[model samples]
Target: MSNYSIKAISNASNDAIIQLKELNISFGITEKTSETLPNPAELFLGSFAACILKNVERFSGLMQFGYKKAELLVNAVRLENPPRMDELTYELTIYTQDEKLNSTLLKKNIEKFGTIYNTVKQTCKISGNIIVHKNV
Candidate 1:
């Protein structure tokens, strides 16, 4: 059996917060309109972004890419009626002092083995692009 548990709290104002007991994190949610709290769907996308970033950081070290900086942008589209995610797009920019390393390989390492990418890809359609810049 898994030793992880999820817990959360919310206010009358519709603000929601959750904690991952295993990871010891407390995250809050707020609505875009303020009429209600941020929906679970939003959190899902946010979690995916976090997961991918974490994996990239770990993989970068193992791959010895000499990264100077990294940034990611994530966007999602939600379906109507069912109010579910239809598509997700990610763009990652990596800065490194070495230009000889193929950016394509770096992108493949992140997208193929990233925990979040694997998890999301199993359930939904996912696609992304990566850009590497010579660090100044």
Candidate 2:
């Protein structure tokens, strides 16, 4: 088994900075308020999106498929009473010239193996579609 961890420091307000020791990256975090920085919920959704994209790139390399670029747009619905995410949807656009690559299979593999995707899928409804575009 693999272990992962991060450190977060919060002030008096609803904001904090998270440090990823392994990645050597730090990000400012805040609650869902009027702050300009990203909130926790947005960060969660973004992490999920990033995980899917990472899997896409990994599969493309392993499957010998080439893509010019990939883009993901994610939307999340939050319930007020309990203040939790109800559902999440995303649209993945892949620009590629590889016609032999099956988009359906690629999406399935990502959703099946993605760490963040599977984790979030357990608590919220996850729905999305993959759109492949022929790169000129």
Worst 10 residues of 2 by lDDT: 24-33
On a 0 to 100 scale, what is the lDDT of residue 20 in model 2? 76
TM-score for each model: 0.77, 0.88
| Residue pairs with backbone overlap in model 1 | none
Model 1 per-residue lDDT tens digits across residues 15-98:
566767555333345444444444566678777888777866787677765677778888898888776777899988878776
lDDT of 2 by residue, 1-119 (tens): 78988887777655677777655333345345436667677788889988999999899987779899999999999999988999999999999888877999998899899999999
Clashing pairs in 2: none
Cα lDDT over the full model 2: 0.84
Candidate 1 stretches with Cα past 4 Å from truth are 1-3, 21-39
